[model samples]
Target: MKHIRNFCIIAHIDHGKSTLADRLLEFTSTVSERDAQAQVLDNMDIERERGITIKSHAIQMDYLLDGEKYVLNLIDTPGHVDFSYEVSRSIAACEGALLIVDSTQGIQAQTISNLYKAIEHDLHIIPVMNKMDLPNAMPDEVEDQILELIGGKREDIIHASGKTGMGIENILRAIVHDVPPPVGDSAKPLQCMIFDSVFNSFRGIIAYFKVVNGEIRKGDLVKFMATGKEYHADEVGVLRLEMEPRKMLGAGDVGYIISGIKTSKEVKVGDTITHVKGGCQNRVEGFEEVKPMVFAGVYPIDSDDYEDLRASMEKLQLNDASLTFEPESSAALGFGFRCGFLGMLHMEIIQERLEREFDMNVITTVPNVPYIVHTKKGEQVEVHNPSGLPEQTIIDWIDEPYIHAQIITKSEYIGQIMNLCLTKRGEMVKQEYLTADRVELSYNMPLAEIVFDFYDKLKSISKGYASFDYQPIGFKPAKLIKLDILLNGESVDALSTLIHFDNAQPLGRRMCEKLKELIPRQQFDIAIQAAIGSKIISRETVKAVRKDVTAKCYGGDISRKRKLLEKQKKGKKRMKQVGNVEVPQKAFMAVLKLD
Candidate 1:
């Protein structure tokens, strides 16, 4: 156990964490040079195409240092803020972390956020500056920044280029020298921490865990501490880029155990596994359940595929424990699921996975944050969708979730960034200049404000140089009202949204205009009106198709043409009074993208 090193790589998006992991695998000969793939840890196609790690990958490696064999267990974690929970779980299962920073980019928002997470976990952090081989690399400045951010000695910082494999050997040596081996007793009853799980049709739930105490073997009966379900370990194996079966896993070893359980819900990430007969009396501490931060309604484009979509979601959720869903129905869109995600990116990934992997076409409503509604009856209710909100007469107040937003950008773009933030109802908390040319701005803003296109706007205004990160602070009381869209005096529930009273009129106007552009012309004039509690704030009209009622009377008298026009106008008024507008799916989606 003393020769084992369990560590994970943490970094901001676009940094060389995955690349560094690949090089580490090569240096240890875990994967042959001829067969090694770029970003080997990123197994999903979406990850490779997006150039980001979406899931955390674990592998066991054998390395030789100073003629001594060492067992290295490394986990490569996702760098996005949406996957922070995954990162945290990885950190909990490791004894150390490699904080990789891009030499040219210095410290990004996620870099700082992830660094603090490692610190919180009390892991030995080895700060490493990557991409030193690039022409724009400035190792000295980044070294200073690392020291300042982590408050560590300069000698502790390592420099390496993942592309050219420079400093790869030193990094390996550092792992042996700097990182502490897992500390546990092999004689103790079996206790393990599950960091991840995947479903297999042939076998079952393959739970990847780190043995914190004692040992586990194939055929041993183990129980999940969280769910209190017991199962016999059908198989135990080490992940050497592939599953290699083993009879037993000792303390400090990281491997997967197949329990023959048919459903993924039986095992959960962060659940503790222990011997069924005798094990640790208490469950392991520091197991935090993943809470979703964003909610949206997802439905299949074709109603017949609803069951297919549900099945796909179940399979996807097996891999993604952060995803939460329940049945939901919309008057316009029909039956669907109300899904919750960690963030916007997480929501997008799940939707993409359902369509691409499961071959199901889905439509997603505008994402929303849960709101606390206080009613006149002295009752508190949580509203996840605007359509589910109670009537205004019964509601006393509405509270929305807010986040502490941190944005790092060049000083030249500070003015534009501040204006954008202010427009989103952001309240300035503090602002500091990280350097003479760069600044870090902090604000308390509603989660709904930035969940949509806030990041895109920030990038555009800053010319793609700014990086933003945020975390949910808590819910705050706000003067919020639901803005409803009325189509010919009928409310469309899917088009309803909660907005601040101050910005409702302008946003309502934009929504009405956008809907006008998206909805096709009908037989009668379609009045697209935005209203707040029966008061119309903004309105736009989709004109009725004007047929040539007088075309056949071209050679007739002018009085006959007038008579025909009058009759056509009267018929149009009657159609407008009774006709129902058929809104397309695109029109509902258009309201969401309205800036």
Candidate 2:
């Protein structure tokens, strides 16, 4: 019998969790010479497009270590903050994890965070110093940090490079020697944690889970602990890592299920499953209810794809539980919907998926941070989308979103970064000098400040030396506004916001220019205006082409050209027809980009 070991690879984004998975597969000979890729576990088109792992994936490989047959079940986890919940869910399914810290970079903010999450989960950790091929690889310093902070055996840190395939065998040996096999009653009632699952038309709900305690087979009936929903299993199989199916999935195994289900929705992941007879009414808790940190409404550019767009969102929700949408009628876009996401990257990812996979053109509003208000009138309310703000309600109290970010960079450029932070009203909470030349700075920064250009700003000021990691820190009260963009004195629902008082003017100027860029040349001179309630501070003019319709008209019909221009004007009319120049998607996009 093969000894089974379940493990997840945890690290910061681009720290190479997927790359580590690829190396594991190669070392174990799970994937052949021709079947290997850089990050094989990143299977989706969007994942490849964004060059990031959006979903958690699992693969099983059989490794022969020191005359022993060890079956390794590897879970590749997402490293970005948006997918942290997904990361936790995947970690819940594993008994051990390989902490892949960059050797040259040492332990970063996210590396520390990921390590803490694993420790909190009570998972045995096997730390590995990866990227030894890089010139800055400091196995000793990282090894010290792991011991000082994580309190693990410092000598256990394995030096390896997943990219160069160096010291990989030692990693395999550590997995077998350091991590223990999962111990649970395989013959008892089935109990598993549903981290994430998807529905396949051919297969019901392909729920991926860990057998926390018990055995579940093809015919087993399982009940969700939360909703009391039950689904009969059609098949249970493990991804063999070789593009083939494995015969069985048991405790300490990472794999997928193919049930006679149709939707990933039914098996809504994070729900615990137990055999009906076991009455294991106990369900796993601590699942964070992630609120969308950023808000944007989306609509089809072409009116005919309305139904298609709805269907696309519906299908997308099955795989992405975080992408949220609700009915939102836009004055300009007609019947569109408001969507919520964790961040700008999340918004872009969803938009890209709709365009690439669903093949639909879309127009998106400016991304805004959500706010929760508690009025003195003893009424509490939440405003997710800026367009959903009520006009008549008397303002009593207001709150805005904020985040706690951990940043690590060289000490030489701290002044530059500090100056940048001051511009955003960032409060420095703490600072620590890790080495002679490096420092770690922690700050309480508004989510809005970091969402758009902070990452790029940090990189530029630090000379590409600074690194960062952050998580949402909940809401804080601040002076904010729903600065509406009015075209020709009409309010465009698409150009609205919840902004800090200080940023209003700069943002206003940026919005005006973006509108000018996105708007096409028209037959009439149009005024592009930016305002905060009737106060127009910045303005631009889109001089319409004097004679866009040439001397030659088809069928002597300037009437046809007039009809075309009328259609264009009608589209602008849907927008808050401010002045004559139409504000295109680019205008709303100004806030999302950095100068």
Q: How much is the lDDT of residue 401 in candidate 2?
A: 75
TM-score of 2: 0.89
Instruction: Quantify all predictions' global Cα lDDT against the true fold.
Output: 0.89, 0.76
TM-score for candidate 1, residues paired by index: 0.95
How does each model score on TM-score?
0.95, 0.89
Total backbone collisions, model 1: 0
Model 1, position 122: C-alpha lDDT score: 90
Cα deviation at 586, candidate 2, in Å, is 3.5
Residue pairs with clashing backbones, model 1:
none
Q: List the residue pairs that clash in candidate 2.
A: 104-136, 204-261, 332-574, 487-577, 487-578, 488-578, 488-579, 526-581
Worst 10 residues of 2 by lDDT: 573-582
- Tell me how candidate 2 scores on lDDT: 0.76
- Candidate 2 scores a C-alpha RMSD against the true structure in Å of 5.2
